[model samples]
Each structure stands twice: as C-alpha cells, then as structure tokens.
Target: MIKPTERRVGYGVAMGYGVTDLFGGGAFAIIGTWLLFFYTTYCGLTVLEASSIFAIARVIDAILSPIMGYITDNFGNTWLGRKFGRRRFFLLLSSPLMFLYALLWLTDMNYWYYLGTYLSIELLSAMVLVPWETLAAEMTNRYEERSRLAGVRMIFSQLGGFLAVSVPGLIMQFTGKDNPFTYTLTGLIFSCVFCLAVFTTWRCTWEAKDVQPEHKFKAEVQRSSGLFNHLKYLILDLISSFRIRAFRLHIIIYIASFTAMDVFGAVFTYYVIYCLGKDAAAVSAWSSVGAFAAIPGTYAFMMLLNKLNLTPSSALRLAYSSIFFVLAFLFIVYYTKTPVPDMVFFGLFILNGVARAGLIYIPWNIYSFIPDIDEMVTQQRREGIFAGVMVLTRKSTVAIAILIIGMVLEEAGFVKGNGIQPESALYAIVTLMTLGTAVLLAISFYVTYPFKLTRETHKVLLKEIARRKLGGKAEDCDAPTRLVIKQLTGYEYDEVWGGEATRRVVGQVNCSRVE
Candidate 1:
C-alpha cells in the first residue's frame, strides 16, 4: 500500500508529467499539423519532397522504439532506488534535448535541412516519451485508479491539444501578420512550457523502492552462465509471452487501431487545407472547437465505460462505429454541396472532439490490461517490455502512415505552387480515407472480441496467481503443462502449487488427489 504522503507526491508527479506530455502534443500542432502546410505553401517544397521528409523521419523513429525500450529496462543507476533506476537519469538528460528538438520547427532551410531537423526532433522526443509512458504504468497497479489517472492525464493532454490548435490564430491576431515569425514564436513558447513541466516532474516525483537490490538477479545469473546465455534467456522470455492468447490478440488490436489513427493524423492537414480550401485560421477554429469539447467527451466516455460495464474492446467498438458514421456524414455534406452553415460545421467539429475522446482514452486503457494478463501468465512483472512493445507498435504505424500519405499526395498531382486541388477529388480522397480507416478500426476491434479479460476475469486471474504462488518457480513448469493448466483453469502452476507431499505420491494417487 502507498502511504498518504506518497500518494500526494504521485498526484503531483502526474500533473507534471501530464503537462510535459501535452507540451509534446502542442509542439506537434505547430510542427506536424501545420508544418506540412507551411512547407508546401510557405517554404516552396514540392508535395513529394515534403512527404518524403515526413516519411523518412517517422521510419527512423520507428526503428528506435524497441531499442530504447531495451535500454530503459536494463538501466541500473542507484542514485535514487531500484524502481527509479536509470529512467529518471535519462529523463533529466533528455528533457533539454526535447527543447532543442522543437527548435527544428523554427529553421528556415532547404528540403534536406528540414528532413534532418524533423528526424532529430522525433528521435529526441521518443527518448522522452518511451520512458515517460513506462513510468505511468509503474505508478500504480489498481484498475480503477489507473483509469482515474488516465482521465487526469487525458484532461491535461487535451488542454495541450487545445492550446496547440488555438495558439496560431492567437499569434496571428497579436502579431498582425500570418507568417513564419508567428510559427517561430509558437514553437519557442511551447518549448518553454515543455521544459518547465519536465523540470517540475523531475523535482517532485518519487519512485517506490524495489524490495530486491539492483542487479541481484543479474549477479545470480552471471555466476552460472556466460553473457550469450543471458541473451538467449531474454529472447526466450519474449517469445514465451506470445503463448498467452489474450496478450497476442491485444497486441494485434493495438497495432491496427493505432496505425489507422496515425494515418488519419498524417492526412488530416491536407484534407483541411487542400480539400476545404480553408486557411490556418479556419483549421485552428475547428481544432480548438474539437479540443475544448474533448474534455467533457472524455469524462462522458469514462461514465459510459462505467455505466455500460463495457470491456475496453466494447468501448472501442462503439467509438469506432460512431466515428465511421460521423465521417460518412461529413463526406456526404462536403461532396453533395449540402450548404452546411458555419454553425453546422462548428457542431460537427464539436462532435469530432467527442469522438476523439474515445480514440485517445480507449487504446491506452486497453494497453494497461495487457500487463495484468502478462503478470498472470509469465509470473514476472515486465511492464517495461509491455510499454516498449506498445511504443514500437505506435511508432511503426506512424512511419507507415507518413509514407502512405506522401505517396497519395504525390499521386494526386499535388504541387507546390498550386493553391489547392479540384473539389471533387479532394473531397473524395478525404472522405474515402476517413471512412476506410473507420472500417479497418471496426475489424480490429471485432478481432479482439474473443480475448475478453473483463474486470471479473482479471480478478479471477489475480486470485489464481496468488493462490498458486507461480512467481517463485515458474521456470519448472514445462510448456505442455503450462498450456494445459491455463486452458483448463485459466491459471498457470509451478512447483509451489504442489509441494513435497504431492510430488512423492504415485501417479494414480496424485491424479485422484488433484481431482
């Protein structure tokens, strides 16, 4: 149990972490959302060139995700405690690097320079994010508490999104100019906010100490085998995790859901700018509307989750269904020249915000479920690996989306000097992309239907884990035995499940006693 004082500190840590994470979103608003438009319209890059830069940067970041996860897991500095480990050390070192990275947005350079800067920023940002998200899972183990904490984090995260989308218009209004200078100012301000939040988290947060000393497990293993043997064990452990059917399903759902979401993000700016022929001012207004509405929308979904007693999978299914219908309606309105008034657009934007609430909330909530299932099956707490895999999957999708969006734009006869595309083609592309992604999301959620680990199921799994005491002697259980036990009883067993008395019994006697 956590002490009262520690809980207070944890809340503080959540706030600080929340702010920093949001800052990254804000930076993306200026850079990722607007940068493409800026490059194609303002910087005079061909659509192909701009797309290439985004695609290449994302690919590089995707490759870095798992390696970073491995490093985070193995880090063992003892200045604080075992739980804190090397995570804080890296966070401190990486904070300023994150700030420097945002400066990439301010650079007025050629295509190659833009490519290099974007890649550098993404790499540094990943360094901060992988550890940052891993720490969230480590903060607590309670299901309801995790949901509440996620709620708090999402509230602040949406606030950052709000600021990101809102700030450009504010900048334009204040500066009396719509130019690169406005973007530079926005980037600098966001960097300051990001740094401040990170510093506060570093100072205020405290990690729970691990009962075991650092490197204790490593020392025992090293006494018996060479380094190659340890590497082999690590590989085997990772492979073994996939034997859990639920975990494997969860991973598949996560990859597909996140990939579709990223693809939507990669193409959204083009839809707004080229398809709608809307300027930054119009995009900012719509985005701000969505962001502000998301606060209530997030809370609403939390309530829906509670009231409906829906599993994460069910909630995601409902969300995707709603999003698909909304996108279809938006497409029809845009394509058919339905004379959508400004108020109607505003309403749809608000609905988009509410829809977005699910997109952000459901996936992470589902992700938290994986570690619990892993702990039950593996009898080892490997939250780091779970977090690392999630990071890897998310970035990999982002990379693919960037590449696909680039190719699509190049094929559409997008050019630097051209103000926009023909209305028919533009609307068709935006509508089809959004609707197509919705279909993919729906299919992924359906695939996860069988892997149902509801609150009741999770409790049962936990009770079984505790009853069997599988943590101590999991290695002794052969694969066939593990699979049989898991299938028959939804639990894994080890030597601790049956002591010397049971072991000493003959086969018939043991079988009868087990029955």
Candidate 2:
C-alpha cells in the first residue's frame, strides 16, 4: 500500500511548484514581444543595436546553462547543498535578483548598459530555471503525479503568456504607449510577480533525499582538482547525456517542434498585418485570446494523456496536425481571397491556441520521466544536466530560427520599421508561416513514430530501476521488462544499471573517483 505522505504532490504542492512558470513563461514572453520595440522606440537604439544585445547575452547564457546544471548535480557534496538542498537554494537566491529584470526596460540607457542588464537577467533566469526544472522528477516518482505537476505548470505558463501580452497594453492605456515610463512600470510589476512566484516555489517544494555517499565523494574529488580538469569533466558529463537513446529522440522532437513554433511566431504578425491587411490591434487581440485559450487547452492535453491514456507522441502528432491545419486554412483563405468571417478567424486562433498548449506540454511532461531512464543506466540521478542541456538547446535553436526567419524576410525585400512591404515580402511571410511550420511539424511527427515511451512503458522502466536499486540482478529480468529496457536504452538487459555499458560510458570521465 502507498503511504499517505508518499504522495506529497497534492493540489497545493503542484500549484506552488508550477507557479514559477509565471516568471519562466512571462519573462520570456515580455522580453521577446516588447524588448526590441521598447529599445528601438524609447531607448534610441537602432534595430541592429537592439538585436545585437539579445544575441550577445544569449550566447553568453548558452555557455553558462550546462555549467549551472553540472554544478547543481554535484552540489550535493557541498556544505550549502547539505544544508539547503541543491536545487531550491538557487530558487531562493534568484528570487530577489529577479528585480534586475526591471533594469532592462529602463530608458536612456546606453548600448553597453542595456547589454549588461540583459545579460544579467538572462544569467539570473538560467541559474534558477536550470535547477528548479529538476524538482518535479525529484519530488515524485509516479507517472500520473508528475503529469499533474507538469500540466499545472503549463497552465500557469500559458497564463503568464496571457499576462505578458495583456499587462503591458493595460499599462499603456493609462500611461500612454509612447512613454518609456510605461515599459519601466511594466517591468517593475512583472519583477514583483517573478519574485513572489520563485519564493513560493522554494517554500512549498522539496528535493529528494541525498544520493549515496560514494557518489557525493566522487563528485567532490572531481571538483577538488584543477579548474581545467573540472571543466573538462563537466563538458564530458554534459555530452554523455546524448548517449541515452530516449534523450536523443526527445531532444530532436523538442528542437524541431519548438523551432517550428518560433518560425510561426516570428512570421505570424507579418502574415496577419501585411498578408491579410489586418491592423496591429487585431493581431494583439488575437494573440491575447490565443494565450487565454491555451489554459483550457493545457488542461485538455492533461486529460488526453492522463485520462484518455494517449501516449505523448500520439498527443504530439494530434497537436501538430491541428496546428498544421490552422496554417493551411489561413494560407488557403488568403491565397484564394476567400471572404472568411471574423468569427471564423477567431475560431482558428482558438484551435491554434489549444494545439500550442500541447506543443509546450508534451515535451516537458515527458521530460519528468527521463531521469528515471537515465537512472536505469547510470545508477544515479542526473536531472540537472539534462535540464541544462535542454535549456541550452532551446535557446540556441530559437536564436537560429529567428535569425533564419529574419534573413529570409530580408531577402524577400522586407524593410524594418516600415508599414508597407513589397509583394514578395508578403508571399515570403505566408510561406514561412505556413509551409515552414508544416515542414518542421512533419519532421517531428516522423521522429515520434520510433519513440516508445508511454505511460505503460514508463511504469515498467521504473519498476526495473527500483528492482535493480534494491540489489536485483539484470540477469534475472523478465522477458517483457528486458524488451522494454532494450527498446528504451538500446542496451542489452545485462549491460545496464552499472554493467559493462556503464563502464564504457563512465570511463569517458578519466578521473580517479570511478577507477
């Protein structure tokens, strides 16, 4: 029988744990949507200058993301880790530091000042997010409970996107859109939200018990060496995650799916305003409604996975299909000059909204189980490293997608800060928004076919890991469990959980700790 306290992820725990998405989702939404406009209009920076700031900061943060992951993974060996826990400590530290995000919106800042502030906020976000992301896996082992946690998290994330889109517009209504002070005030409000959300997460969430002393000692020994050696080992450790077959597939799907969204996001406004000859206010209204619509969509996806017992991959295909249909409908209506009603457009946005929630939900929901798979091979928990790598890949791929979109538009004779565009530019916008998105979704859909992780298989994998941890031999595995292990890890039954495969992968770290 399950103990009463075993299921600590009640509604309160899930709410507290998920609330951090207010910052996680809102901060990015605000920055991505408004920062460039704010810099160019009020801060007296050119488009190139503003874009360069983001590029420089993102490049710097991409490097730090995995290092922060590696640090937290081994941090259990430290005095601070012993006292406060490895992951939540960063949440506590970053709570107050979130206020620095406000500085990025302040006007009259020089280029260097903007760069410094933007870099600071990005680094601060990574420091907290990389560790905080590992908490769901650390807190619970049940598939349903973890799904609940991730589902709530995505809902809040959608809400954050809503607030990010709406709050600034509300502030502008009172303060006037042209005033720089409006953005500064908006930043202060969001900073407060971020601070409170992170603090609540720290207070309400808890980490797992410490790992084995031997593992901790080995981590300490590696850190005790020269900085160069420590860096080398960290690099090796980060790369080692790719050796896990499931993670490799997960990353591919993640990159392809999200990059598709990025391309669509970058081009959609252009498609609406330029291609369809709609107003900016209409686009903003559509975006706000879409954001709000995602809340229910997220909940519905949770049901699809939890109640309906749909695999994440199947759910993902459904989402991609919905989005694919939306894009196609929009393209067809515009190309054929169909007299579509406004309500119909609104309905399409609602459908797209629902689909996007799955796009955000499934990969992350599936992510909570990945550490269990990793534990089966290494006999250790390494959620931090995987989180770090995911963040890094996310940032890098998004940057590339945005860059490609910009280049393609520019090549099509698009001009910045101009109300009108050439005919070719409009065509380019529709093509990227429709065909480009469809292509990426196609890639993701194809990749998902080979993916075998589902609710049922996850249970099997977890059972095997538990059995092995309790000193069961791999040789004694049942045929069904053995097949599942081989399918998931691409390792023979006897080659996992500290077997020959472990030595082969572990030996990549040429340190005395393991030898």
Candidate topping lDDT: 2
lDDT of 1 by residue, 178-240 (tens): 577777777778777877766666665444334332211111112135577545544544555
Ten residues in sequence with the least summed lDDT for candidate 1: 506-515
Q: Relative to the unseen true structure, what is the C-alpha lDDT of residue 431 in candidate 2, on a scale of 0 to 100?
A: 93
Tell how far residue 497 is off in model 2, in angstroms: 1.6
In the range 15-47, model 2's lDDT, one tens digit per residue, is 999999999888987776667667766787755
Local lDDT at 339 for model 1: 71
Best by TM-score: 2
Per-residue lDDT of 191 in model 2: 93
